[model samples]
Target: MVLYAPLLFLLVLVGVQFALWALAQLGVQYAANHALQTTRVSGGTAAAGRADAAAVLDQVAGQVVVDPRVSVTRNPDTATVAVAGRVPAVVPFLRLQVTTEVSAPTERFRALTLSLTSPSPAGEGDPR
Candidate 1:
């Protein structure tokens, strides 16, 4: 019974560690997505994206993620955000880092112009 019990305990610890890792990964991904969305919108900035990511991490995964690093970039055409952090160690010897990146085109507003003249009949417009 002793041998079997230790084996069972180890298995349970491993499972719990895996769950923690998964949770951390998911949290980082969510933060990255939110940051990307914030930065991709019109008039958004990279600083705003980083701030948004930090806020999200603090609100959602503060305990699970440790020392999170957020990076954001914005340009004329596209925006990107990345979040990375180490997950709280569940097993004595195993430590894992979770990272996520998201990117999309920046939002822009353009003026649409309407045609001033109506089209002629198909046969009449044709040269033939």
Candidate 2:
């Protein structure tokens, strides 16, 4: 009976540790997605994305992660946001890392062009 009690206590501790890790994962993902959404908007720049990611990490995952990193990339048609960091783990010997990326299209409209040309005598004479 004493042995069973110890084992049950260990199991409960493991469960609690796992739950904390899961919550940290969710926090990182939410931060990454929010940063991406902000950067993908029209006139938004990569600098803005990085700033937003940092802010979110501080607000959400600061306690769980150490040495957080944020990266932002831009293309003609799309923008990308990446967030990465290390999270505290249950075991002291093991180090945990988390990374997430999100991308979205820029919210802008392409300008339409219209062209008009006068009829030429060469076109009227050529039936072929």
TM-score, structure 1 vs. true: 0.90
Worst 10 residues of 2 by lDDT: 87-96
* Tens digits of lDDT, candidate 1, 63-128: 999999999999999998989999887778798999988899999999999999999988787798
- Quantify all predictions' global Cα lDDT against the true fold: 0.92, 0.82
Backbone clash numbers for all candidates listed: 0, 0
Give the per-residue lDDT of model 2 (tens digit) for 31-128: 88988888888888889888998898899877887788889997779988888887776754657787888888878877998668767688685699
Identify the leading candidate in terms of TM-score.
Answer: 1
TM-scores of all candidate predictions against the true structure = 0.90, 0.76
Shift of residue 76 alpha carbon in model 1, Å: 0.6
The residue ranges of model 2 lying beyond 4 angstroms of the native Cα positions read 112-128
